[model samples]
Target: MKKITLLLLFPVLLIAQEKATTANTAQSGRYDTNKFSQMYDLLATPNMFRTASGAPGPAYYQQQADYKMDIELDDKNAKLHGSETVTYYNNSPDSLEYLWVQLDQNQMAKDSQTPLAESEKMEQTFPPSNFADKFLKKELERGFVIEHVKDAKGAPLSYTINHTMMRINLASPLKPGTSISFAIKWWYNINNYQTEGGRSGYELFEKEGNRLYVIAQFYPRMAVYNDVEGWQNMQFWGGGEFALPFGNFDVNITVPADHVMEATGELTNRSEVFTAAQLKRYELAQKTFDKPVIIVTQQEAEIAEKGFSDKKKTWKFSAKNVRDFGIATSRKFIYDAMAVQLNDKVVMAASVYPKEANPLWEETSTRTVAHTLKSYSAHTFDYPYPKAVSVSAADQGMEYPMICWNFGRPDENGNTSEQIKNAMIGVVIHEVGHNFFPMIVNSDERQWTWMDEGLNSFMEYMAEVELGTNFPSRRGPARKIVPYMSGDQKFLEPIMSNSEGIIQFGNNAYAKPATGLNILRETIMGRELFDHAFKVYANRWKFKHPTPEDFFRTMEDASGVDLDWFFRGWFYSTDVVDIGISNVKQYYVTETPTQELKNSRVKKGRFDLEKGPFVYLVEEDNKELRARDKKALKIEDVTLLAEYVATVSDTEKDAFKTPKYFYQVTYNKPGGMLMPILVAITYEDDTVENFKYPAQIWRKNNQNAVKVYATEKAIKKIQLDPELETADIDLTNNTWPKESLKSKFD
Candidate 1:
């Protein structure tokens, strides 16, 4: 008889185990609940606001500027000379009194205020410089000088010159919403940006006597005027980026015939610059997607190295719908190209680095660029430009529209470390990806760094993962962010801080927002939904100035998700995540015994005669229901209990049920942010159950919450939020039945 009973129990255990496994599987898959839900909410919310509010949209404003620049690079003296005519278009609503031109390289001049001002910021997040004086005091600072300013008609205009900035006063006030034409002559001293500690220009490599030129902010350009920030007057103080109005750039760069050059525009004169074989290969590259073909081959570069050409050829490029322009040119450049098909359009992905940047650069840099194009195109719109270039520099990584400068160098023996390789690939992918972010998305880096930086960084993380089969990414994943998320509370700041002054500035401004977006894509919002909504935002505001509200509204409008809480918590507040499973109570119920003895006791004055007969006595001496009793109790002993339960009609059957066991679980939220609670229940038979509560479960109770479960099996253990992907800063209190019992040492 005992063997037969055990056999019957085995089937029940099997059934319980099956249900438990299914529940645990479901629980483990529910991640990033808050992010996607918020994305959904953001998509659902409607907007009545008329104008867009951020930096991105203005950068997309349509305008065209035709530039005729005659530039000369002096390798001997480390200086540059140029004269240019600009046909500027005023596409904004407000009128302009004078056009502003950026003399970006002038920041390296002795008189520039940037180094002095930035050096005073001792609490900067990145490298701080006390050696500014030594760098600035160096002779031949190689800064730009603006000599003349004139209209298309040759009449001179009054202009003011400051270090790295030149203001050209217009002869006549150009009214709002109109185009103006002008020209200027300028030259600049070129200092080594890598070792000399400036934002733009180049660094001197030890062996070749060759300088890597990552020339940007090189031309005089117009300032932006929009609803947000009125005029982005934030001066460039070393590390901050740019804010400029959108326009076309028709530039002609003159480098030695042997030098390989790439810039921010379409190569209109490729036949004049590239050999017949190279041009043929360039045409073939459009059809080749598997790998890159060499444009300026290693053999060709070595041959060019043997003999320097004095004869120069002008490479003309015309870029439409670009906000900024930059160029990189050197005889030392080794060039390779790959093609990426986006929306069926063949976009070229190129890499150019010196011999010092080879081996590692040859492997990852080109592939990383190709990966970025594919991933970003899926998340945003297709690549609009014909080419995206990544050039290797030694110092800082900065972005332009068609080209960007990245930092990564091999060791002395042509050996590169993995960290260096990853950093180089990551930076290259990041900067090239920025062409889609602020370059075309047109967010104002001067006002809201996250609008472009955060968004681009988010894409960079995704691109990195997609580039390699098992890429070890440093940011974006939930587990990867725990150290940063759990840092000292005093150092933490919300991602919505003003661009100019932010504490823990890099974390608050870049990493957090990027992580938040990653959480949205992987955990909160599933890829399909997030990708669609993001692509919609990109397409909707492709050539327009998009404010934060525009992004917030568009995301919701497209995805039909309400995301106000997400924007409020992640972007607006420095909320930590510290939710805990507070408590769990288990109980079982059975029928009360009959009261024949109670009546007899009442007559003996041991019971209250006025009390109801169905009353369950609280006496601890009740023998029928002992403390050690494990048997299921019966309801027949109490006739009144049976009648009470029988009184429920068919209509009330839904509310009336027999539950042998009961559990009350309490959850607590010690952090400012709210995330979904994932609960796992394990039974005595090695069975498990899982339940999920939305982030809104804590809306009414920020400190703690309560939940009750009814089950027949005994609960063995309970766990809360098992996966570490939520970026929960604290994990010690996550499990119920606390495991840590510290021993007190005297």
Candidate 2:
């Protein structure tokens, strides 16, 4: 057949073959309805409170709840007692009939339903200790013991406790632009965090008869009331975190006289609590920016641990515009602090750890804190608080307003492996970066885990990489997420899932979204645009509440890029990217028709030969046609072509270059996800050219696409996603000449 005739028939033959294959198939259906559409159905409609541009609308308002607490840590009893007076200012347009308080300590109650909600399965072999801890231990007395709830006038207020939440009824509906004052007196038995597994508690050292307390969620806190989910009274089921309104705090914590304490706020009476020598060291640390200055040396801490001081000292602290409060206190803590300059302001980076955390904690904890503040502040907003503290605890990595609990303990002899060291630094960065995420940016972590954990983890990866090469980052690299992205569908959940609903907590809540943002920064949007948009999101939402829509809208609005496709695929669906080169064909230029064309014309009774100037295509494999053309024709022998070239203008000739080779490249997508097509084309001269087509290229053809290119050099090979930027799952079909697979033996 003639080349033109064969080309025309190819599509028809393909249609026939496709129809035959469909007839033989047992199961066939239409396309998935949820695959390609926008996320309108899944997202709430934009309103005046939150505009389409992702900025807070004119009507946006947030409530404020200030606290004045007098907390006492009963070290001998392993308990916490507090009397808090909350001053709530209602700034919303609507009236509040009642106030919801989060009693998170109730999650550990002996009668708590959290344990019942989990499913227990029998193990093949269980250790005697594990079996006893799981099934034999007597239930401990847990949850808050509410003493009294009273109004500002000292009148008893009506309240009811249900699970992990409490409702306080008011005498009248609290009007907007009004304030109310109430008091709550409560106490709870602090569990051993190492044994009970909690965000905060104490780690006991039986041999030394000492304990390190890392405390949070220790008091009655007000739940967030905002435009979205009016009253975020979601019960604390243990996985999803808190959603609290921003407020100021004045806390007076009374503990053992020998204890060294670091809390969420600035210590108001530092001189009163610190000795002469310790006060001098802390003052020196405030000016020392290069390295940490020991406020309480390990030797002093060890000596203090031996003495059970009967006298108590009260440490007063006051924090402004913070959402939560946490404190770490221990007589065994070796306290150190250093200064870090951030934009016109100087902030302190401090570490409080037991002697067991020496070497690793002393050498890296304060440094990691300083690095995190610099890195996160550069990307997001400045560290607004006075200090960022990292307290070493056993198997605990959790964040609060100005302080966080990190796990990095060396052996008894102070020796740690590289893996342990990396984990220490990584966790410190991750927890400290949280100050920029939900802590100040204030996303609701109860509803969306990725908003806080994922974003913070991504920042952690960046800080880790900036710290040094071979930093062993755990997330925020495209390649690191491949195994989870391509895992069994049954075991996978989209990043949009609730914290409690996730199947694989680590991958779903942290790794996937972090990797997605990395891909956006390095591959999709480029670093410049991504960083600017990210900073915009951070600054716009700082000290405020932001929903998922606000974040998605702010990124696009700031960057001038439409990223709905990315959000829909990466966050809303369990889709994987898999683009490959399906087929390739090469063609050469010719002036004369071959024998097949002549036969085709004669068979069709057509005699239009030599009627007009025409160009023909000859396949590279057609040797007979090439041999005939070589013997009968020359470069200047084509009369029609020479006539065309002679008539063209000088400007046109200078602007155009004749192509020596023509190529038809076809790309196919076997996976459901859509991503930018990054191609690397190689020439026979050992040179390469790269081209990137936006993801919109798949709009017209979702399954496959055909692209034609003309080049001066013969095409040698082609590669799709040469750098693995899209997290493409399957690489076997990514190349034109498929790479060979190695056998197990080989």
How close to the true structure is residue 133 of candidate 2, measured as C-alpha lDDT? 80
Query: In model 1, what is the error at residue 475, expressed in angstroms?
Result: 1.2
Weakest lDDT window of 10 consecutive positions for candidate 1: 3-12
Q: Tell me the spans in candidate 2 whose CA falls farther than 4 Å from its real position.
A: 1-38, 593-611, 621-655, 742-746
For residue 712, what is the lDDT in candidate 1? 68
lDDT of 1 by residue, 1-746 (tens): 11110101100111112236455464536555443344443322332323222123323344445566767777656777788888776665667677666666666666778656653534444333535544444466456666888877888888887665567777677775677777788887776775566656777765666666888877776666565545555666655577776776777777777788889889998899999988998887777899887778777877776566878778888888888888898888888888888876888899888877778888878888888888888878888988999988887789898899899889879898878888888898889989888888876776778888888888888888877557667667776666777888787777766675666666767778888887777656668877888888888767555667777766666676666776767887778777787776553332343253334433334234354343232222334544533233244443555565566667775675554455677898877776777788888898888887777776655678888676667677888766665778777788877867354462
- Candidate 1 to truth, TM: 0.82
Tell me how far the alpha carbon of residue 557 in candidate 1 is from the true structure, in angstroms, after superposition. 2.2
Clashes counted in candidate 1 amount to 36
Each prediction's whole-model lDDT (CA): 0.71, 0.88
lDDT of 2 at 60: 96
Off by over 4 Å in 1: 1-66, 118-142, 161-166, 591-660, 685-688, 741-746
